[model samples]
Target: MDPTHSTLLHRLLDATTWRAFDVDAEGRILAGHDASGSVQLVELRPDGARVPLTALPGAVSGRYVPGSRRVVVSHDAGGNERAQLSLLDPDAVTAPLGEDELTPLVRDPDHIHGLVEVLPTGEVVYTTNRRNGVDFDLVVHRLADGTETVLYDGGGMVGGATVSHEGTRALMTRPGRPALSSQVLLLVGDTTTELTDAGEHARYGGLEWLPGGETAIVTSDSGRDHLGVAALDVATGHLTWLVTDDAHDVTARLSPDGRRLLVVTDDDGASRLAIHDADGTFLRDVALPAELRAGVADFLTLPRWSPDGTGLAITWTDPATPADVLLVDAERGRAGVVASSREPLADLDLVDPTSHGVPTPDGETVPCFVYAPPEPSGSSVVIVHGGPEGQSVRSFSAVVQALVGDGHTVLVPNVRGSVGYGKRWYSLDDVERRLDSVADLAALHTHLPRLGLDPARSALWGGSYGGYMVLAGLAFQPQLWAAGVDIVGISSLVTFLENTSPYRRAHREREYGSLERDREFLERASPLNRIGDVRAPLFVIHGANDPRVPLSEAEQVAAAVRANGVEVEMVVYDDEGHGLAKRANRLDAYPRAVAFLGRALA
Candidate 1:
C-alpha cells in the first residue's frame, strides 16, 4: 500500500542537503544550481547577460568586496587555506590569495576550509574555523599593509556570515557548547553583541541581512520542538517571530529580495513547500505532481528554491526509482522530472559507450556510473559514492559533470549497502556483510577490464565510508586497482561509534556492531587493524574540524599508510568537516584530485 515514503522521507526529498542561491543585486534570472549544492555566484548586469561569477567549488562563504573587480572563493591548497579570487568580467579565473598575509591561522585536520569577504578598503574578512565542537572567530586583514586583527572570535562556532547591504555591519549565528543549540550574534564596526537568546541549544540557521544591515532574517527552531521565521532588529537586538509553528516543524529561508520568506516543512510523511509573507501570512503551497510525491515520505525536508521564485526544487522519489531532482511550481502546480538516477549494472566507462551494469559479489546485478574523457581508452577514475547506505543515481553531481566535461569517465556505484532499493537490499552490508560492499568494489577491476575499462588506468575514489571502501579495495585486492583515494574514511570502526558526533554517535551500533558488545565483529569491519596487507598508491583528504569521523580517523590511516611505504598523499582542511565547503577548498581539492588520479591512473 505504501510505495512511497509516507513519512520523513517525503518531507526531506527537497532539502536533503544545504544550498545557496547567488542572485544579482536585482535578483534577475541568473545562472543557478540544480544540484550544485550551495556553491556558486553570479554577477548581474542591468543590460548585459547576468553573468554567473560562481567558480566551480567557489566561495560558498565569502563576502563581497566593493570595487575589488572579483570575488574570493576560499579553500585549502596543499596544507594551507588558499583563496581563489576570480575576476568577474570574462570568467571566474583569477590569482589565488595565499596565507602570506593571514596568520594565527590553523589548518586542523578536521576544520580546514575558510570563508572570505573582501572589503572596499582592501581588507579581507573571513571565518577562521569549523563548528567542530569549538567556537569560531571572524578575522579581518588589510591587503596593502598586511595587518590582521580579530573581528570577533564569537566563541568558535559561528557560521553563515552576511554583510549589510550598506557594507557596515555583519550578521552570523553562534552555537553554544554541547553542539545542538546556538544563538545569533551581530557584529558592529568595533563591538560584538549577542543578538538572540532563543533558548538552550536552539538551532539558528542562515542569517540574511536585509536591504541594509539594520535588520536580518534568522531561521531558528522555536525550541527544537517548533520552527519559526523571525526578523531581528540589529540596533535593539530584538527578535520577533514571524512564522511560528507547533504542529509540524519547518525551516525558514529569506528570499533574495527580503520581502517574502521561503518555508520548508512537512506534515505526517508528506513534504510540502509553503511561501509566506514576511509578516507570517501564508502565500501558497508550491505544488508537486502526484508521481513526484510518491515515495517522498519527507517533503518539507528537501529544501530547494528556483532563482525566479516561481518553484522549489526537491528530490522526488518512489519505490520503483531512486530519488532525483524534480522541479515543482507553486504558481502552476506542476512537477517535471529533470535527471535520471538509476545505478547501472556495469562499469560505465564513457570510453566504451556500450558498457553496461556489472554482477555483484552476491550474484545480484547493480548499476555503475563511469568517469572518463572522450577518448575511448584514456585515463580512468572510478569514484565509489559514499554512504555504503547510499546509491549512485543519475542525480545532479557537480564533480562528475566537471570531470566528464574535462574528458574522464568517473564511475559511481550504487552498491548493495545503498538505499533506493528495498530495505533488504539496503541492509545487505550491515554487520558481517560489511566486507560484501568491499567485494563488490573489488570485482569492478575484474569486471571493468573485461568490459574495456583499462584496469591499469583505473583509480579508486570516495569520501566518508566510501573512502574506507577505497582503502579496503586497494589493501585486499592491490592488483585489482591502479591506485586509491580515501577522503575521511573510517580505517577503523572499533572506536568510530565512541568518538563519533552525538548526532551519529549511535548510528554504527546497528550497521557495524558495538565495540563494547561485539569487539570481534567491529574488528573485522575496520581496515586499519589489517593495513599491513595493503600495497597500493593512496591519497587521502580530510577536514580537520570534522566532528563525524574526527581528523584522527584519517590521520591514523595516513600515518600507517605512509609508514608502509605505500606512497601516501594527504590533504587536510583545517576548518571543514565531512565535505569541502569554502570555494578555496573545493578548487584546491579538484586540481589535487586531478593530479592524483593522473599519477595513479596514468
Candidate 2:
C-alpha cells in the first residue's frame, strides 16, 4: 500500500492514534491494546509473545511495566471531561493502579501524563510539570518502593528511556537551548554523559541501545528536510548520519544478531523500510508504506517490526476506503495487503470531474474535490487543511459533514506539498512559494463558477497552518469570497516561531526560515505583516492556552483587523491547547462557526 493515492477513512480516524505495544524480556510480542481492559498479556502461543488484548476501549495513551507483564492504558471517558488510566494483566483483565498503588500519583482535578515502564527491578513513570513557558522537568517514580525521583529537570525533555541490555545505562532525550535540537544522555550508575550536541532543531529523541550497550542509535536532520538515523559510540560520544539527500525519517532497531538495523521512512513520499549492517550501511529494504508515514499527534510513528527483522506490518485507511494492514518482506521491500479492518465501505459518487483541479501560478496542475449535500440555493465554503503537509481525503470528516449539514458546500484543494503526491509536488510547498498554495486555492474558486458554483456564496476556512493559508488567501486575494474562519492559525511566521516551543524551533528553519537568521524571508512569507490588506468578515478562533500556534497569534490579527473595522470576530478558549480537545468547546464552536459563516457569506 504505497500512498501515492489514498482512500477516505485515513482522514476520518487519523486525527491522532495510540495502541498499547508490549514486548517481553526476549524482545518478542507480548500484548497489544488498541483499546484497553480486555484479557491482557496472556502469553498464549510463543514464549516471548503475550496474548492480544482483543477488546479495546479506545485508549489514547499506554505503557508496559517492566519485569511484570502488565500494561496500563489511558482514555477520556465519554460525557466525562476527565481521563482514566488502568492496568491490565496478560488475560486482558484490568486492575486500576489507584493513587495508592500507581507511581507518580495522579494529579488532583487532573490526570497522569506519563508512559509507565515496568523494569525488572522497578516500575518507572515519566510525567511533567511546566515552568517558564516550557515543559520544565519530568518527575519519575520507582514503584518497587513507590519512591519518586526527578531524573531530568526543566532544562530538557526526557523520554524514550531504554535500559542497556545489561541494565546499566539509561539513555534518554536531553533538550537543549533554542528548543528540540536535543542531545542523548546516558545515566550510567552515577555519571551523566552526553552522547550528542544540540544541533539544528533535530532531536536525538527516539533512541535504542545496542544489546551489549556498546553503541546507541539516535535521529537527527540532513539538509533541513528529513530525519535520518545516526549511530553513536556509547563510550566515546561520536556520531554519524546513516542516510543522505532523500527526505527520510527512521526508527532503528538493533537486530537480535547484533549486526543489523531495521529502519523505516517515506524517503520518496512513498513508504519504505530498510535493514542496515551494524555499521550504518544499507543491507536490505523493507516493505511498509502507510504505517511508516502515519501521523500520531505531531510526529510519525514507526511500527514495530518482527523480532527477527524478517517481516513487518502496519495499518492505513483513507476516506473512500476501509482501514487495512500491510505485511511485507523486510529485506527486499516486497509487500502486500495482509488484512482489511472491516468490509469495504461503499464508494462515493463523485461529480463534475471538471471541478476537481486547480492550476498553480507556475502552470503545475493540482486536484481539488468538493462535497455538498443537495442545496439548490445556498452559499459554498472552500476549506484548506493545516499542514500544507495534509490533503483533503475522500473519507468522512466531522467538520465537512457539519458544514454540509448546514447547507454549505466544502471544497478541499490539495495545493502542492500535500502528501500522497510525489516528492517534487510535496516540496513545492516550501517557504519562498508559500503563497502558491493560496494562489491555487483562488484558481479553484474561479474554476467553480464555471461548474455552476456561485462565487457570491463562496468563502474560505482553515485552521493551524491551513488557517494561515485561509488568512493569506483573503489577504492576497481579498475579492475571492465573502467570509473566512481562521482557527488558532499563525498571523506571522516570524513571531510564531520566535515564541513557539522548542519542539518546533528547528522546523521553522526548513519550513519557512529562521527569524533571527532569515528575518526577511520569514517576514515575506507571513500574513500578519500584510494583515493591513485583509478584507473579509473574519471570525478568528483561538485557544488562549495554546502552546503551538499561541493565542497571541490570533490576538494580533484580531486587534489589527478590528482596528481597521473590517468586521473581525475573535473567540478564545483558555482551557484548550493547540486545538479544541474539550467537548464543550467543540459543541459551542460548531454551531457558532456555522452561524458566522452563514450570516456573513449567506
Candidate 3:
C-alpha cells in the first residue's frame, strides 16, 4: 500500500464519533462515545465534564430510567446481538464501570431480553424469548417484589412494548403478515385487543401516548403508500391522520408536555424536521443547517425532547460529519452542537455523494448516492446496503471516504427491496422476486459510464444482505464486476435459513420465503449454487459468532470458488458476530479489503 493511502485509511478508521441517545431532566446526556476505542455510555454533564459510565467489551447503549437518576444499560457479548439489560447509577460512579457495578436486570446469554420501558413505579417492561427460543413475550418485572407478569403472550414476535402513563395499560407490537407491516396489540388490565386490523397490509410503529393515555400518536401507512403520523384512539381502532404527505414518510415525537409535537419527514433519505401542535396544526419548520440531517430511521438515531420540552436533542449528520447530538431551542427553532466528534477530521476534506436515480430495465428508478473523487481513477465500486429493507442514507461513513480518498468512485444504491422508497418498492424483491434486486447491480454497472467511470473496472461490496448482493452480482453477472468484497454475507439462502437463529428464522422467512415451502426457490436464489460462474477475485469477511448468517455461509462459498482456481481471501473475527463493531478490528480488516480492491481493480 502507498504510505499516504495507509495513513489516510488508518486515520479514517480510527476517527471517533459521539452520539446522544437519551437526556434527563438535569440536562445530563446519556451519550455513546468511542473515545475508549469501543462505543461506551458516557454522561455528558451540563458543566462540560464527561464521565465514563460502562466500559464493556462490546458497544453499549443506554437510556435514563424515567423519573429517576439511575440508568439502564444494554449490551451484548461480542456481536451476537442477544442484548442483555443491566442498570447503573451515574451519580454513584466516578470512573468507568467495574465488573460488579453493573446491576444485572436480565442476564441470560441463551436468549434475548430487551428492555422496553422502565416505569416510575420500578416496573421494567421488557420482551424476552425465555419461554421458547422462537417466540418473544412481553413481561413486566416489578423491582419492588421481584415478581414478573406476562403482559402479552399471544405468540409470534413481540416487536415492541410501551406502558401507559398511568401504568394501567400497555401496547405491544407484533409482526404482520409480510413482516414489514406491524400490528399493534393493546393491553388494558387483563384484556388484549388488536389496534390494527389483522387483514390490513399497513405498518404501524412509533407509538407515543398523550396526557391521559386515551389516544396515542403513531406513524402508520394503513391505507396509503407512504407513512404518515396519525393519532389512534385506544377505545376504538380509529385513526386520525395528523401529518399526511404524498411524497415521503413522516415520524412524530410528542413533547414532554404532550402539547407540542416534533415531526420529521423522510424526504428521499434526508430529514425535514417540523413542529406541530397536538391536533397536527403546523407550527413552523425547524431551520436545520444546510445538508445536516436528523434521524431518518428510528434505529439510526432519534430526536429526543428534554424532560421539560423546552429544548430538543437530535442526532444530526452530514456526509463529512459523523452523528453528533445537537441541542435545539424549540421555541426559537435554532440549534447548536452540544456533543460532537468532528475535530479529528476538521482539516481533512472528505468526499460528498450526490443523489441520483438509475433507471432499471422495468422502467423503475433505483435511488443511488454516488461519491466521485476529484480526479478520475477509471475504477469504481458499487456498495450495497445490508437491510434488504435498509436504505443508504447520507450519513458519515469512514469506508466511503477512505475509498474515495484512494481514488475509487463509490456508488451506494437502494435497490427494489430497500425501504424509504415506499411499500411497493420494498416488496418488489420479496420471496420469489429475490433475484430482481441482483439484476439492479447490472443496471447500476451499465450506468457507470454516464458518471465518467469505466464499467469494466467496477467492483461489488456489501455486508450482511448487502454481502449477499455482492456475491449474487459477481455470480449471476460474472462479466460485469472486476472484483467483489462480501462481509458477513449469506452464500446460500437454504443454509442461511437453516442455521440462522431460531427467533429470526420465522421473521426472516416471511421475507426470504420459508424453508418448508420454498426450499427449491431458495436453493435457486442462493449465490453458492452459481459460484462456479464467479470469475472475479473475491474477498470474504465474517464473524465466527454470527447468529444471523452463520460462519458456514462464508466458508462454503469461499471454498467453492477457490476450487475453481480463483483467487479468494477470507478473514474471520472470533470476537465479532454480524459485522466488525470494534475499531481495532475495522482498522485491521478494512485496510486489507481496500488493498485487495485496489490491486484487483488495477
Candidate 4:
C-alpha cells in the first residue's frame, strides 16, 4: 500500500460510532460501539463514563430491561447474522462479558434469534427460527425458570415483534412473500388477528404498541407511493392515518404516556422528524440540529422515547461525522449530544457528497451521491451499495472520504431495486430484472466524463450485492471500467442461492429468484458466465464464514477470470463473515483495496 493511502486508511478507521439501542430505568444507555475494532455492547453513563459490556467478535445490539439492572445483547458469530441473545450485568464493570458471565437465553447453533423485549417480570420475548429455519416464530423465555414458550408461529418471515406496555397483547409484522408488501398481526392472550391487509405492492413496518394495548401505531405504504404512519385497532383490523406525507413517514416511537409520537420521514435519503399527539394529530416537526441536518442521517437509530416521555435518545450522523447519541427535548425540539464517537482526522480534507439523480437509458432517474476532490484527478470510482433492497443514503463513510482524499472522485448510487423509493421502484431490479440495475451502473459511468471524470481511468467497487454490480459492470460492459473490486459479492446468482445458508435461502431467492424455476435466467444474469468478457483488472475479497454469499462466490469468479487471462487478485479473511467486521481485518483489507484501485486507476 502507498504510504499516503495507509495513513488515509488509519484516519478513516480511527473514527468510531456508538448506536444507542435502549435506556434503562437508571438512565444508563445501552449502545453498540466499535471502538475496539469489533462492535460490542457498551453502557453509556449519564455522567460521561463509558463502560464496555460485551466483547463479541461481530456486531452486537441490545436494550436495557426497563425495571432490571440486566441488559439483553444480541450478536451473531462472525457475520452469519444468526443472532444469539445473552444477558449482561451492567454494574459489574467487566471487560467484555466472558463466555461464563454471559447467560444465553436462546442458544440454538442452527437457528437465529432476535431480542424483542424484556418484560418487567424478567420474561424475555424474542423471535426465532428454531421451529423451522426458514420462518421466525415469536417465543417468550421465562428468566426465572428458563422456560421457553412459543407465542406465535405464522408461516413467513417475522420482521419484528413487540409486546404492549401491560404485556397482555403483542404486535408482529411479517413481510409478504415478494417482500414489497407486508401484514401486521396482533397477538392477544391465545388469539391472533391480522391488523392490516396492506395488499400487493405495499409494505408495512415499524410496529409500536400503544400503552392502552388495544391500539398500535405502524408505518404503511398501502395505497400510497410514500409510507405513512397509521393507528391500527388490534381487535377490529381498522386503521386510522395519523400522519401522511408525499415522502416516506416512519413511526419511530410512542411516548411512555402514549401522548407524544416521534415520527421520521424519509426526504429522499435525508431524515425529518415530526411529532404527533396520541389522538392522531400532528404537533410539530422536531428541528434537527444543524450538524445532523447537514449530512445524511437516513439510518438514525430508531429514536427512543425517554423514561419521562419528555425527550428522545437518538443516534445521528452524516458524511463528515461519526454517529453520536443525542437527547432531544420533545417540547422544545432542542438536542444535546449525550455520547460522541468522533475521531480527529489529523488535518485530512474530507469531501461532503452532493446528492443527485442520473438519467438512465430507459428514462428512469437513478439517485446517487458524488464526492469529488478539490483538485481534478480525471479518475473516478463508482461505489455500489449492497441490498438490491437497500438505498444509498447520506452517511459518514470512511472509504468514500479516503478515496476522495487520494484524489479520486467517488460515486454512490442507489440503483433500481433500492428501498425508500416506494414499492414500484424497489421491485424494478428483482429476479430476472437484476441486470437492469447493471445497466444503471453503465449509465452512471457514461455520465462521469461529463463531471470531468475520465471514463478510461474510472473503476467499479462494491460489497455484497454492490460487489455483484461491480462484476456485472466489468463483464456486461467490458470497456466501460478500467478496474473492478468485489467484496463478498455474488458472482453467480444460481450458485449463491445453492451455497447460501438454508435459513436465508428462501429470502434471497425472493430477491434473486429460485434455482428450481429461474435457473437459466439466473445463469445468464450471473457475472461468472461472462468472465471471458471482463477486460478490467479485478480484485476480490471475501470472508470464509460468510453465510449469505459464501466464500465460493469469490473463489469461483477469481479462478474463472484468472483462467481467462485477466489480472485478478483474491484476499480471504478467515475470522470474518458476510463482510469484514473486526477492525484489524478491515485495516488490512481496505488499504489493499485503496492501493489496488490507486494503481489501476492511475
Best by TM-score: 3
Runs in model 4 lying further than 4 Å from the true structure:
197-199, 288-293, 296-300
RMSD of 2: 8.1
lDDT of 4 by residue, 247-324 (tens): 564555778777888877776777777678977677877776564445443343566776778887788877766787
lDDT value for candidate 3?
Answer: 0.86
Weakest 10 consecutive residues, lDDT, candidate 1?
1-10
User: TM-scores of the models, in the given order?
Assistant: 0.50, 0.63, 0.97, 0.95
Over the stretch 211-254, how does candidate 3's per-residue lDDT look in tens digits?
88889988888888888999999889899999989888788888
**Least well predicted 10-residue stretch by lDDT in candidate 3:** 291-300
Q: List the residue pairs that clash in candidate 4.
A: 296-394
lDDT of 1 at 428: 69
| Deviation from native of the Cα of residue 358 in model 1, angstroms | 1.5
- Tens digits of per-residue lDDT for model 1, 87-147: 2332433432233422322334455335544544656666655454334567666655767
Q: Give one clash count per candidate, in the order shown.
A: 86, 33, 0, 1
Mind sharing the TM-score for model 1? Answer: 0.50
Which of the predicted structures, 1 or 2, would earn the higher TM-score when compared with the native?
A: 2
Worst 10 residues of 2 by lDDT: 1-10
User: Which of the numbered candidates is closest to the native, going by highest lDDT?
Assistant: 3
lDDT of 2 at 267: 32
